[model samples]
Target: MHLIIPNWAGVPANIGALATLRSGGVSQGPYDDGNGGGGLNIGAHVEDAPQAVVLNRALLGVLLPASPLWLTQVHGHHVVDAGEVDNVPGAVEADAAIATRPGVVCAIQTADCLPVLFADVNGRVVGAAHAGWRGLQGGVLQNTVARMRASGAGPIVAWLGAAIGPGKFEVGADVLQAFTDTAQAPEAAVGASAEMTPAARMAQTQACFTPIAQRPSKYLADIYQLARIALGQAGVTQIYGGGLCTVTDINCYSYRRDRVTGRMASLIWLK
Candidate 1:
């Protein structure tokens, strides 16, 4: 099983974090690894055989302290406590989860969408957020950071997992407008000094979308840059682990590249 361990120096020794690649599991067909091996598609909602997903998750579970708290991602900004998720009936519909207790894994599944993992530098808490374009524009990462801070976390650091790269992620004017049109400061702007003025923030956001001359009303949006701006606005400055492009990297899954593709998981927890 190949896993991308986050190379983040800000993470405390007690915290554990890893992003799963498409390789290593029992899934087949569209969920199969791009190189013809079984894939590690842990997403239960992706229409893969239920039994295969079970086995794949079981394989992943062997490396974790406990089973991951998987949420039904809605591409929204809702954040939840990972420890409280299991007590709820049915599947939780949050796009991000924070874990204050040890061994409580906060997991986010994605193919093209960004999976961001967060942790307190002091190892007090950990979190995972699924940030598709919608969720990113909707404030998912800020909400996760706010929840972690509310739970007593200190100086949080984040690691950006694999996602569609700027070169391959094409977006329309509406997608660009969704970010540029909003000037609200991040919900978790920790200090007044760290806050970017509404105009500055909008300018930073506009820079993330580059117009594609060949395609009218189209642009190449850099999800990583957008994430960095958002995290910076939220007062999280020590960020790491970006530039892995799912669409171009065969080891990772890419829904945009393959319409019927498997999903990879990015997970974090306190040991």
Candidate 2:
């Protein structure tokens, strides 16, 4: 299979977009070799062959306008400015988000963690973020949008890429409590606030406005909902994508389903 993510209908006039699928690359067994089995392990740390990672990236390179800003994702909230980025993934430490001048491609790698691409309708700037529950609650999207705005971008449009869907993402009370403060957040997408202890609510206000959804005592959060609330707070409304589920779709990768799984990349740039 070709690593194609049609999450977004088209790359907006000023913006360009493409996210990688798990199939159609190098590696073997659980990682698939082009011989029609499991394949395309892009994560360098996945115990796959280093040579294979290089080769897979090389194949991807042929399609990108520039090298992707691969990050060491630890499920935290840190958005780095691409211009100030150390020209390498290591120098820039952030779990979710990369912004670039024009040709700079902001890239995010994920297996199940959501990869979100942001671009102004005019395409003056482009950015990408990794929005795992922690990062989403931690405000990675808002942080990234802030930087992009500094560059005179945003109130932007966003593309929410694939990740584990809610039906599969079960959680505990802590996760549900994470969003109490989001009431103060510019907005919340239904079920955002339930009944938590006053202390829990205070903690939410102090920490970051982390929105983790819940069902009854525990909300079965739709990560997409969290992203919407968070981005909406940052004045980002024209969001797109958020349809595919990595855990269910074999074509995409999923960390929750299989911890040692391949990774996919979401990229955005200005044309």
TM-score of each: 0.94, 0.82
What lDDT tens digits, residue by residue, belong to model 1 across residues 180-253?
A: 86644454234432456767667777899999997898999999998987787678889998899999999988
Model 2 over residues 1-271: C-alpha lDDT tens digits? Answer: 4655544433467577788887778777566633456466778878788888888888888877778777777788877766566667545678755555666777788887888888776567778888988898887888888888888874577888888887777666677666665444433332333444455544544343233454445445578877876776677767788868888887777778767677778878776
- Candidate 1 residues lying further than 4 Å off, grouped into runs, are 87-90, 184-197
Cα lDDT of all candidates, in order?
A: 0.87, 0.71
Q: Model 2: which residue pairs collide?
A: 31-38, 31-39, 32-38, 32-39, 214-219, 214-220, 215-218, 215-219, 215-220
Error of 2 at 163 (Å): 0.7
Model 1 pairs in collision: none
Worst lDDT 10-window in candidate 1 = 184-193
